[model samples]
Each structure stands twice: as structure tokens, then as C-alpha cells.
Target chain A: MAAQTKPVLHGYFRSSCSWRVRIAFALKGIEFEQVPVNLIKDGGQQLTEQYKALNPMQQVPAVEIDGITLSQSLAVIQYIDETRPGPRLLPGDPKARAQVRMISDLIASGVQPLQNLYVLQKIGAEKLQWAQHFIDRGFQALEPILKQTSGKYCVGDEISMADICLVPQVYNAERFKVDLRQYPTIKRLNKTLLEIEAFKVSHPSQQPDTPADLRA
Target chain B: MAAQTKPVLHGYFRSSCSWRVRIAFALKGIEFEQVPVNLIKDGGQQLTEQYKALNPMQQVPAVEIDGITLSQSLAVIQYIDETRPGPRLLPGDPKARAQVRMISDLIASGVQPLQNLYVLQKIGAEKLQWAQHFIDRGFQALEPILKQTSGKYCVGDEISMADICLVPQVYNAERFKVDLRQYPTIKRLNKTLLEIEAFKVSHPSQQPDTPADLRA
Candidate 1:
């Protein structure tokens, strides 16, 4: 067996993207240390020059592994799935893999960023309304696709990257007051997912940096 | 040799996501039939009941190939790269592949959706400013990473998916009036990318459906 290395993840408590990396680590059973970079404090610590140097994107959930730091939640997860001994986060067949990626990208690109903190801040007074609109648009598409793609998980009973992307985006949706009642498939899947050790332990409320009052 | 299937690409002339697929198809030497989905006509053709059934996301650049219709530009590109005999779009090494994905997702998730047509419309009076801000923010991160990751392309000398993503986004940045001079690496890479046949041919102005006045 290769030497075990504990990766260091630079992230915050409430960031959906950072929350994604946490779940992947838990699901894979890769023990790692978490360093909180409070996004809200000091006008967003992620926007600071030091954090920006660490991650040019200045985004939470940058992972330090094998002496290299990688940003982008999906990329960080992919690296962990690839280099570590973990449950495969992607599948074998070409088409199945594409389906997994399609679902993941739908949430990662199609939904999440549009309703993210930065974009929400720009929306000002109508932030909630804007978040709901984009979330609804995304979930409407995702529900039907998830119906076709999901079976106990986001992709056919196997916990894949799509599921990793799904849980946090669903958390964000609920935060913005988008009714998951409209997205039955997503709701069902999120319920099953939240029960899993990885998803449960990695929930924003359960994170190390989560405020005591916010802890559930 | 397998039977020649002229894959039909469902896209609009101006959709950056669609433009990404067009470049990938051209790069892979895939002969695809272009089906123009007029996003601006009839209150957006992509939102039609018929189109939504085809792609629940109602997004442009869904491709029909081998009797399967796939949506999401990155997913479609991955499908094409995987099943077809062509120059590879992602690298062989997992770390390298992760890097490519990081850059691609940066544009796909981090930048594009925030500045998408739907988001801009919702921004009302601040559309251009909003677009410029996100584009500039994304490009700032992208430029430095591209410097680390590029030789002739966004991820080494190979014209990977990152390059495919980069060109359309640079086009968007220019469209939004964001100064490319501020992102020297991106500007340089975009210049070189436009000179390539695949990217040049797939450009918005060169598309079959582009308005005569808009045509180059």
C-alpha cells in the first residue's frame, strides 16, 4: 500500500463548493485537515491577497495534496477520486461516465454559480427571488434527468460525482427557499444522500467552522 | 470502420456553450449537421415544450448522435472525445486531466452562467457592468493559471477542452467590453486560438445561422 497522506483542505463552513469537497473526502474515507477561510469575515477572506495567491480564483475548497494545490470543487474531487483509495466517484463505461458528467455539470455550471454568494450579493434586494428563479430553472431540468439517471443515488445506485454536486446544490436551493416539493426526484435523492455518513458529516452545520448556534 | 453518422448538433449561433461544442466537433474531425435552435425567436425556442422534452434543461448545444441526445456542452464534448477516434481532448495523466477540468469548470461554472443571457436580463440596468465584473474576475484567475498550464494551449501544448472553453469566454469578455489588455495571457492565447481552423470555423460569426449583418 502507498503511504497515506492527509490532504489539507482550505475552505469555509457555509460555502456550497467547499461543502462538496468535504463530502467527497468523507465518502472516500480520506482523512484530511480543514483550515477555515471565513468568506464573510473581513470583507471575505477569500478576496484577500494571500488567499488569492494560494488560489488564483480566491475560491474556497482549494485542496493541497501531494504538494500541489488545486481549486475548483469538481477538480479537487476528481483528483481525490483518481489518486486515492476510495469508492470510484465516476463509472467505467464511456456513455455512463458521460451521463454522470452531464448531470454533474448541470448543477455545477447550470445552477450553482448563478445562485452563488457573489452573484447573490450583486443582485442586492432581489437576491432571494433571483436565486429561486435560477434554482427552479435548474431543478426543473435536473428532476427529469435525475429520474432517468438515478437509482438510489444520483447515478444508478453508485455514488458518483453527480451526487457530490447534487447534495450541496440542493442545500443551497433549500437555503434560498426554493421548494424542493416541486422536485420530487431531487428531494428523494437528497433524503437518501443526507442519510449517508459522508453527506451527513459534511453538512455545513456539522463542519468544524460551523458556528455553535448554527450547529444542528 | 464504423458507419458514418452525421451527428446533428442542436445549437444557436450566439450561444457560447454551443460554440464550445462546435469547436470540439471540428477538432475531432466529426462531420455534424447543425440544427439551429433560435434562442431569441418565439421567446426563445429552447424554452418551447418540444425543445424542453429533447433537453429538459432547455439549453442550447445538445447533440444527437448514435440515436442518443446529450446536453451540457462539457458532457457532449466528453462523449464525443470518448466514443470517437480523434485527437484526445483530455490528457492521459489524471493530474493533467484534473488541471484541464479545473480551467474548463472555471469558465463553465464560475464565469459563463453568471453572465448568461438570462442572468443579464434579470440584472436590468446593470447587465453590462455585471457581465464585465464576473468576466474580469474569472479572467483574472484564468490568466495566471493559463500561464502556469499553457505552452501553446490552456493546458500544455495540446488543444484540450480548456482551450475549447477559453475561446468562447474570451469572445464573451470582448463582447462585454472587458479589456483583454488586462489579461495578457488570455489575450495572447485567444489570438493564437482564433488562428486555428477548428476554433476559427466554429466562431459565432462563421456559423450558418448568424445574421448577415453579424456574419464575418
Candidate 2:
């Protein structure tokens, strides 16, 4: 679990999705080398021939383990939990696992996609507007789910995949200047997660590759 | 689980999302009343206050189960799978479950959100054009995963959540004039799933609530 022997994480410094996986690795005390892929610089280093070999989608946070490169942030992190020894990210039960996944999909699919750089770039100057629009809509749907599922973290006291999904989403939403005021359950749970160093240390602003202007 | 004692399902005749759940419920042989909610009438009957009370999001396929209503198409379906005793909708181990979920999320979150009615309305006439655009994007992402995961069904020989998710999305994509030649796996899988009566019976064209123009 020491820092030096960590597996390599090929990711963008400011990618919230990457941050989510980083947080999970941190929480599990799994050592990982942070290999930066600057998404915006030079029109995305992720799209280079070498990186594309790692991810066909040319997406970030693709991890290399046992010489096998895995894509998709959630899938990669779940693979880590499944293969590695540490605290389990997903719960043991089917229903609880479903709950963890529902939250993960909510953030990963619902909230995160709407604000992703590609999506933002697609919509043009209306990026900020679309970002807020989807964030609130996503959080609105997520708020009640959080209330029903959360205790201390996203689903009871012990951290699971749900918290891994939550913190990065809140971070991205704030980056887009979305008003998180409407979702109290989200706000409360996020505040609790913030207290954990695992969450803070994995934040995009704290990443070594983050640009000076974007640093928190 | 006779028809009379079963729960009620409020959905449109042609909403592929509803059709997917209907097929699931039918395969489980859990009877239910199909109360159609017209999506195009008066700007969507789902917007009505009574419907909103049943589902805050005011979307269809809301199930009134044991007097407690539930929303979100996937959540509703998962609840059914958990409570019912019939054939399981999702097959395989936790890893398989995650795979099925990833595929479902790829479509449900990744594809459906982009081609939503509200999204179409927001963007106007160019909407239909982008519908195929997003569907193609989704199917492209899905083909490889399904190819890797398939054994006859999405995760194996038995039909799982991946099948449920796939049927609807493919249905919509075909309806939008998207060519499925490149998505051979999805096309082959859809052809196989069609052999089952559960899926056949739930086709949007057969629904009482389906709009005449949209029906196949």
C-alpha cells in the first residue's frame, strides 16, 4: 500500500471522473502512479495514438494492471475493488450493490456526462447554462435517492462505491458554477465526505498535473 | 400472480423504455394493468399534477406497487426483479451484474438522455438528425462490450438487464433510420430476443396508448 509501488493511473489532472477513481484508490490505500493526460492542452493528449491504444474511446482514467489496460472509469475502479484487497467499494448484497450502482450511474451517467468537457464543447458557449441545467436536474433526481440510501455516506456509515461516485460529481457541478443549494441531502453528504482526507487528497485541484489557473 | 391481483403500470404504447419493463414483468409472469400515459397529447399527459404525484419526474412507466409509487424506469424494473419470483431479469455474478449494468447505463444514461423528448423539443427540427447521431454513438460503444459479453444473451445465455436495455434502444434507433449494420452483435441479439413472446407482446405498436403516427 506504499506510494512507490502503486499501479499507474493514466488520467487527466482535472478530470472529475479521474478524480473519482483516484479517491477510490486513495481510500483503499492502494498505491497508484498518477500519469497525467492533459485533456485540453494541444486538443487533448488523450486522443494521441499512444493513449488511444490504451482507450479506444480516447477517454481518461484508463488504468493498466497486470499489463491489461482497462477503460471506463467506473468499470476500472470496480475491477480494482474486485481484484485488490482493501475495503470493498460495492456492498456485499444484491440490493445494496444495486443501490451503490444506481448512485454511481446517477453521477457517472446522469450528472457527469452532462458537464463533461466533450459535452460542454459540443454545446458551445451555452456550456455553463447546459451544465447547470443538467446538474440541478440530476441532483433533484439524486436528492431523494440519497435521502433514502444515505446514512453517513451515500449508503450507510461504511464507504462504498456510492461515495466514490458522489464527491467527484459535487466537485464538477461546483466547477461549472451550478447552485448546489437545492440539494440538501447532497450538500450534507458532500460535507461529510469532505472531512475525509481520501476525498480531499484525490481532488482535481490537488492533483500535480492541474494547471495553475485551475488550482483550488 | 394472476392479472387481477397484480400491480399497475402507467406507460405509453410505444415508449421503448416502458416496453422493456413490460417484457420483464411479463417474463416474470407478474400480472399488471397497463395504464397508458400519452407522451404527445397536450404536451405530454405525464405533466399532469396527478401523474406528478405518482412520479416527480413526470415520466412514464411509473408503477403503483403495493400502494407506494416508484419512478425511474431502471429503479422500477429492479424493484420488480427483487420482489418477483419469476425468471431473473439480470443473470450472472457480481462482475456479470456490473457488466450488464455498464451496458444498460451506456444506453439508458449515455444514449437515451441525449435523445429525450425534452431534449428534442429544446433543439427543435435538428433533433431527429441528432437522434441517430447519439444512437449510433451508443451502439458503437455497445457493440464491442456486447461482443465480449454475449453467450446468447448480453451477459450469457439467459436474458439479463442488458437485453432489456438493448431492445428498447435498438427499437428507437431503427425507428430513427439509423443503420444497424455495424452493430451486428446488437442486431443479432435483438433478433434472438424477439423470439420471446414477452418482448413481442410489449412492442410499442401494440400498445393501446401508442400514437397512431409513431406506431410501426
Candidate 3:
């Protein structure tokens, strides 16, 4: 609760939403402690009453900062951006900011949720097909929009929340065997973002809870 | 494109995402033109190349405002809130703003997308059961958070984007037969929000494209 207290992140190593918050913190040069809530452990640790108390949604990447806990990766990212002094995660211009939000929401709300671990578990035997179908659909729409919006990043040369959202999604796409060649703009943008130090440090493969075999 | 030009909204009458935009515009008292893109007509009008050009995502509720076309309801609502002079759609306080964003994302990304027509169509014969399951899961999480955050609205006394996201999802919950008694806080907030003119005018049944039998 004190101003000098380090923030705590309750997250899973490979959860895209959790990765988003990690990238935001790294980009802002803010140090935070990690409390990994392994999503797949013991029939999902996030479903336990203890973790649910921190985030009633029982989702990973619930952050305790500035004396309060916040969930939803986009919310956590924006909060860190607003309260921290760093390179802006959202652009200064209103239109560009809107573009960044549009891209972020398109992936966060429209695409990723369809293929998430929880949803796939419910999806049963056809999980791979379901994940591939939705990822492909999302990337198909994303490609043209990125072509219009990208300069050096997802919106006119700035590393933004959109760029933060892009990499994890592309990682998911590759995991599901979605061909990147079909979405050249998204592919190029994800590649460009991955080389950034903040993204590299915050990557799923680099996380504290990343299984030893999966660590970078 | 000009400041004086009326914005054009391309949307479906029943889409909760589109309804969220309608509520925000009405709350801000912005006058705009509506172009109905019937989702079920002609095997889905939103699938047309013409509509896809406006929104690469092929979703309803794409808005042409200030010369740029934006898809994604939350992005469009935030754009209007930032640019227009009206009651704030987002609270000014940092923590409160994050709470609003959290609730909005919970419903928008977590609950609604899973039950959307596209997803439900894929769900086949078990569509009702699938919708009920997710709505119950979302409302279960939301009820407790709303209990913690609500004063007279989802975050406080003022109507925020969280309120905009809540009503439509509640409507969907009712349509899917989720019991409202289980979520006293959400039910109370939705009841209070519905009495306001902005929400009433923006209800799905009152839309310009609402079919004769369906109109309120």
C-alpha cells in the first residue's frame, strides 16, 4: 500500500494476458514481484477461492499496485501507463490512441478469448481446430488494419499497447499452427516488436514460472 | 470528415457491441446517422466487401467519425468521451478509471464474445446451454466486483463505460435465461441504468432497424 512498496503480479507464465502486463511493466522500467498462479495446476489455481479473492474473475494477471488490485490486462496496462512516468504506452494524439485501443480490443476481446485455455478445455476434442479457426479469422481481419496503421509499430511508429497485444497473439497463432504468411502485416509487426528489450524480457519463455524446458 | 458532419454508424439492431456504442453516443448527446447493416439478412450483410472495407473485422457498429472509421465499441466510446463535452464516460480518478475499464473488459471480452451469434452458431444444438454457462460464470464474477465498486453505478455515482457495457450483457443474460437473483448488484445497476433516457433510447428493441414485431 505504501508508495515505495513493490507491486505484485499474480500471473501464469504462458497466459497472453499475463504477458501483456509484464511487457507494460518492463516498458515502463517498473520493478514488480511475480506470484505465479499456474492456470493448469490442481485443476486451475485461478479457480481457487484464494486467487478469486484477488480477482473475482479468477483470471491471471491480477496486479496489486498503488494500494489496489486490478485485473484485465488492458486495464492494468493503462493504469501503469497513467500513473507511471515512462515512454507513453498510449499515443498522445486522440485518433492514434483510438487506433491503438481498436487494435488491442480487436485481439483481446475478439480473438484471444475464443481460443483461451478455459474455452479450449470446454471445446473438448476439436480444440486445435477451434483455435486455428478463430486465430485465422482474427489474423485475416488484423492484417489489412495493420497494413493501414503500422509505421514502425502497430500504430504509426510508436511502441504501444497495440504492439504489446500483438506479440502474444502471434505466439498463440504459431502454437496453433496458423500460417503467418497469410497475414504478412501482422507477422512483420510481431517480428519487429519481439526484438525490443522490454518484449524479450517479458516474454512467456523468459518468465519466472516458465517451466525449465520452456525457458529461453 | 468535417467537424460539422454528422457521424455515420454502421450497426445491427441486436448486437450488444453496437448497442454499447449507441448508449455512449446518446449519453454524450451526439447526433449521428444510422446505417443498418443487418447481420442476418442476405446471409449476413456484414460479410460483404463493402462493409468489410469500413471494418476489417466484419463486425457491426463501425463508426465513421471525424473522417476515420473505427470498429470495436469500447474504442469508439472512449474516442467520443475524449473528444466530446458531456458527462464523463470514464471517471477522472486513476483508480476509479481502472475499475471501470476492468468491469467493462470483463463483460466485453469475457462474456459477450463467447455468446455472440458467430460463436453460438458454431455451438450448434447446445447453444442455449453454452450461452447460459458463460453468462452464469461472468455474472458470478461480476456480481461480487460490482458489490465492491458500485455506489449508484458500476464504479461510482457517475455513469461510466462500465455501465455502458453492463446493460447489453445483462440483456443477453436475460435472453439466455440466467437468473438475475443471483447477481443482486448487477441487477440493481442495470435496473437503474435502464431508467435513464440514454439507455432507454439505445435499447435494442428501440433501434431504427428493430423489426416491426420486435420494436418496443
List fnat per candidate, in order: 0.87, 0.11, 0.82
Q: Write the per-residue lDDT of candidate 2 for residues B1-216, one digit (tens) a residue.
A: 344466889988877677877888878987788888888989899889888666555666677776556555676677778767888876646567657766776677678877877677766778888788888877876887788889899988888878998998888898789999988999999999988888887888777766678676
Interface RMSD per candidate: 1.1, 3.6, 0.5
lDDT, candidates in the order shown: 0.89, 0.78, 0.94
Ranking by TM-score: 3, 1, 2
Instruction: State model 1's lDDT.
Output: 0.89
lDDT of 1 by residue, B48-96 (tens): 8988888998888788887777899999998889888889999988888
lDDT tens digits by residue: candidate 1, A1-216: 668578999999989899889989998988899999998889999998888887888888788888777899988888888887768998987777888989999999999888878878877898899899999999999999889888999879899999999999998988888988988999999999999999999999988999999999
CAPRI grade, predicted model 1: high
Clashes by residue pair, model 2: A6-A31
lDDT of 3 by residue, B1-216 (tens): 445888899998899999999999999999999999999989999999999999988988899999899999999999999999989999999999999999999998999999999999999999999999999999999998999999999998999999999999999998998888988899999999999999999999998999999988
How far does residue B97 in candidate 2 sit from its true spot (Å)? 3.3
Model 1 residue A178 lDDT score: 90
Which parts of model 3 are misplaced by more than 4 Å?
A1-3, B1-3
**For residues A149-204, could you state the per-residue lDDT of candidate 3 as single tens digits?**
99999999889999999999999999898888988888788888999999999999
B77 Cα displacement, candidate 3 (Å) = 0.3
Candidate DockQ scores, in order: 0.82, 0.25, 0.90
